[model samples]
Target: MLQVNNIEVIYMNIIQVLRGVSLEVGDGKIIALLGANGAGKTTTLKAISGLLKTEEGEVTDGSIVFDGKRIDRYGPVEIAATGITQVMEGRRVLGHLSVEENLMVFAHNRKDRKEVKGDIEKVFEYFPKIKTLRRQTSGYLSGGEQQMMVIGRGLMARPKLMLLDEPSLGLAPLLVQEIYEIIRRINAEQKMAILLVEQNARAALGIADYGYVMENGRVVLSGAADMLKGNEDVQEFYMGLSVAGSKKSYREFKHYRRKKKWVT
Candidate 1:
């Protein structure tokens, strides 16, 4: 459903971030982009969603195509209308609005006015924890609730392709599990294509059909999710598991860097 071919993203016409990064999200398939902080995972999403232009970032090299249409030069609104919605990392929500109101905001552009309420109910179904809090001020919700609300809001747009950036950030382990399960269900039931950017390698790979490892703005590795899960380097670096299958501390390998073998 989406393709990013050798795209390089530059900010303010000077600072280059992405260097020949390319990946794909197949129809109704979950693709995971795994990397640590500052690996340009989020920037890739912005480029695909056309949110890069908002930060004075441009895809100066290569192209981004969605549903076979070239969208590298498109603006955020135009890209969104083409069935892409980015649920950004920060779990952003409107402080003053109620949870339902926050969700309703995304549907304003929809012509299906009557069905909007039904869609709200569908979102509630996916996130039953937020149903009771629908009329409550969103700012007062807990962090997990806020995260659920934001994902639900993105669902309001009924996007075909959802770019999820760091969805598990700052949440408890159990809450992370819950949200990831919901994301998996959303993909299976809605047949929505998802490009997931995450530092939590285990959770992302668990549901991903395929995966890519990024470093310093380039793809260092790419493989089927199961293959990545069993990889020694991936186990050591991302999962904190040693070759002996023992859990190791990040401090034990702080300076370790994987030898890059870029997928061609």
Candidate 2:
């Protein structure tokens, strides 16, 4: 449903961030982009969502096409209108507004005013924990609640493609599991396409049909999720596993360098 072809992103006309990065998101499929910090996963999303322009970052080469239309030069509003919604990493919420109000904000652009209420209920169904908190001030909610609220807000837009950046960030392991399950359900039920950017390789690969590994702004590896899960390098580097299936210590893993196969 979406394609990023050899795109290069540059910030302030000088600092290049994404170099020849390319990937595809099939209709209703979960595509995971796995990488650590500064790997340019988020920047790729911004380029596709046109959020890059906000930070003086521009896609200087290649193209981003969604639903067969080129959108590399479009602005954030235009991109959002084209059925793509990016749930940014920080779990940003309207601090002063009620939870329901935050969800309502995204639906304002839709002409289906009456159905907006129904959609709010749909979001509540996905996140029942936030239902009773609808009228409460969003800023007072716990971190997990805020994360649920933000994903629910993205649902309000009724996007065909959702770019999720670090949805599991700063949450407990059980809570992360809950959210990832919800994400999987959202894809299956809504037939929505999701490009999930995550550092939690295990969780992301669990639900993803296909996955890409990024490093230093380039794709180092790409494969089916299960294949990646079984890969020795992926197991060792991302999952902290040794060849013998034992967990490696952080100190041991940190000193290891990734293979230079993609570096030519």
Candidate 3:
């Protein structure tokens, strides 16, 4: 379980990125955060995973609590040790290392060598394709394969909560479907809670139990995934499907007031 409560982040201690952003991820449940590029989705993830500090950003106000422990002040390594790991926007992997080596790199905090080896097998079980390419250089893998490797690498951390950022970016439709199904499976099998940051509204909402929409560093909407999917604002802006069958530009959307309100 994780809670991000009214947290604010400042980059370089000047540009404030998040303003009172709050959300929750319950045990083994998937929660989606959907918005356009500058809505602070990735920053929210970085804040929770303690990656923001790497960019000279810090949670300046409010709290990030994971299983009752305040983790806003912790570093990335400390956060990961607490069973929270993030797979960033890009499918970032060690380009020079073999797939096996890339996966092994994450097990640094893990104490048992034998258990780490067993965990690698578990990752292989989730991604059979990666098992075959274990020795192959990770950079040579295709986009879909690299995405799989990234997710597989996250699993190697044995995380209790997984922060997934734009998992379907640049992948084909079929591959997106496959990866989403795997994500659902991983949730069911590992009982790992997921906080998904995505622009793919249809795909993310399809699998998420709950959802939030952000704009300008704040949460603009929150609801059950089905409720969000059926919402006019979400349909028009995020899903690109409007009941009126017309998309509104950002300018038009700003002037157009929401008929359905959210919890502020």
Candidate 4:
């Protein structure tokens, strides 16, 4: 469980990136944060994961409460040790390390050596392709494969909450579908709580239990994923479509609004 209160983050020279953004993720539920670029989606994730440096971009207000503990002031390593791990936007993997070695790197902080091996096996079981490429260098893997490896490494951290930022970005449609399927499986079967930041609204909402729409660093809407899926504003602004079965097409609607000066 996690609660991000009305937290604010100001970058260098007081550039306010997160404007009192707030949201919640229930235990084992997938909560998707949908927004365009620069809506502070990634900033929210970094703040929660303790990757935001205090001296540069401070948490000017509010709190980040995770599993009954305040973690706003904690560092990234401390956050991981507290059962929170992040799979960032780029899916950063250790380029020189082998697949198994990358998984092993995360286990240094883990106390259970026997369980570590079993846990690595569990990752391999979830990502069977990783097993086949166990000895291969991560730098040589394809983008989708590298994403899987990053996610596998996160799993090795034994996270209570996984913050996945744009997991489907830059991947092919088929690979996106496959990765999403794995994400769904993790949330449903493994009961892993996920905070998903994605521009792929259709797919993210398709798999999410609940959704939040952020605009200009503030949450504009929040509801059950299905409900938000059918919302008119969500469809028009975010999904780039008019209301379902409307006589006026999206282009026609936009033209009319523009003519009337209803849209700038």
Candidate 5:
């Protein structure tokens, strides 16, 4: 399990980006962090995974705890080795490397060659298509394939928790559904925990056990996924759906949410 407690983040030690943002992911559960652009969803992930310093961003307040220990000061490599891996927003594969080679890079530090091979086979089990492209250049794979490959690479780490940012970003709807299915399977079968940050609210909430909605760098609303889904404000703002399938005027929707009454 992971806990982020009242954490504030700042960039260049000047501009504050996350204002007391907090959330949690329990063992074998999926938690969705949903918001529009500039809402600090990614900032929260960077804070947890210790990637903040790379961009001159730092956690200025509170703490991030993994399992039971504080992990706020650790570097990304140390964080990854602690059974947490981040699949960033962009699919960043080594373009020149073959798919298998790209995956091997994550497992390269381990001395157990047979275990590494079995892990690769396990990835293949979840992603049969990746097997065919094992020797092919990663740069040449389709966007959906590249996305699968990135998640497959994360699996090579055998993480207890996976920080997933925008996993369904540019893929087709069918592919998005397919990927979510596999994600659910991994959480169930592998006992993996996922902290999913996404702008694709519906898809994320569909699979998440709990959901948090952020606005202007703070958590405004959070609850059980089903409760958040049924919330009128969440329905109008994040979901783009309304009661009885009737559409509300843009002005009316804004007025309802901007009051912030629902959040209180």
Candidate 6:
């Protein structure tokens, strides 16, 4: 249960990133926020996570409520303590820390030490590579492994709602699929609600129960993921083309190249 009221996030008074943004996440459903770069996806996540001090960005307009509690006013640590965790973009792992140590850092703050240890084992079970590299420094992990470690560390918190930002970014297609599959498993098996923010609209929509399309700052479309997936406008604009069985096609290839230009 997460509700983002008509919230506006402003930066430096000159820049406004999220404009009257509103959405909901029901129990066990994966809700996706799809948009291009600078579309306020990350800003929305930051606002929800309390990382963007509300007084600074100032949800000057609306409120965000989670698990029946008004959370828009709380700070990042407070939000995390309330069972909302964010695995931020770019896999922000502590490079100097060992894999196990990184997990232990989060676990130390949790309520149940025995359960935390059990969850650590469960995370390792989910990503065996992390277990194998327990003694290795995080800097040595591959991109996909780093992503797994970040997700695992978030799991250590036993969050009721997880805000995942671009879990598929920088990974190969196969790894992207692996990551999404794990997200699906977490929702299906663990019954965790998720607010997934991804530029990879196709993959995101494919797995999400519901989807929201955002542009510039506002939500342009919101509906069932299946409907958005079939909508021609979504395909031409946000999703581009289907990359089902084959490699990114000629048109898709060109679209990817053009997108990379802007992203870089």
Number of the predicted model whose lDDT against the real structure is largest = 2
User: Which segments of candidate 4 are over 4 A away from where they belong?
Assistant: 245-264
Backbone clashes for every candidate come to 0, 0, 0, 0, 0, 0
Model 6, stretches more than 4 Å misplaced? Answer: 242-264
What would the per-residue lDDT of candidate 2 be over residues 24-56, giving only the tens digit for each residue?
A: 999999999998799999999999999999999
**TM-score to true structure, per model:** 0.95, 0.95, 0.92, 0.92, 0.93, 0.90
The sequence of per-residue lDDT tens digits that candidate 3 reaches over residues 1-264 is 799999999999899999999999999999999999999999999999999989999899999999999999999989999999999989998999999999998887888889999999999898897789999999999999999999999988889999999999999999999999999999999999999999999999999999999988999999999999888888977777656746645555455545535435
Instruction: Provide the clash count, candidate 3.
Output: 0
Q: Which parts of model 5 have CA positions greater than 4 angstroms off?
A: 245-264
Q: For each candidate, what is the lDDT?
A: 0.93, 0.94, 0.92, 0.87, 0.89, 0.86
- Which residue pairs collide in model 1, if any? none
Give me the candidate number with maximum TM-score. Answer: 2
Residues 37-154 of candidate 4 have per-residue lDDT tens digits of: 9989999999999988744777778999999999999888898889998888998889999999999998889889999999999988888877999999999999999999888898
Residue-level lDDT of model 1, residues 104-151, one tens digit each, is: 998978999999999999999999999999999999999999999999
Q: Give the runs in model 3 whose Cα sits over 4 Å from its true position.
A: 244-264
Candidates in descending TM-score order: 2, 1, 5, 3, 4, 6
Residue 168 miss distance in model 1 (angstroms): 0.6
Cα displacement (Å) at residue 97, model 4? 0.9
Candidate 3 scores a C-alpha RMSD against the true structure in Å of: 3.5
lDDT per residue as tens, model 5, 59-116 = 9999999999899998887887888888999898899999999899989667788899
Candidate 2: regions farther than 4 A off: 249-264
Ranking by lDDT: 2, 1, 3, 5, 4, 6
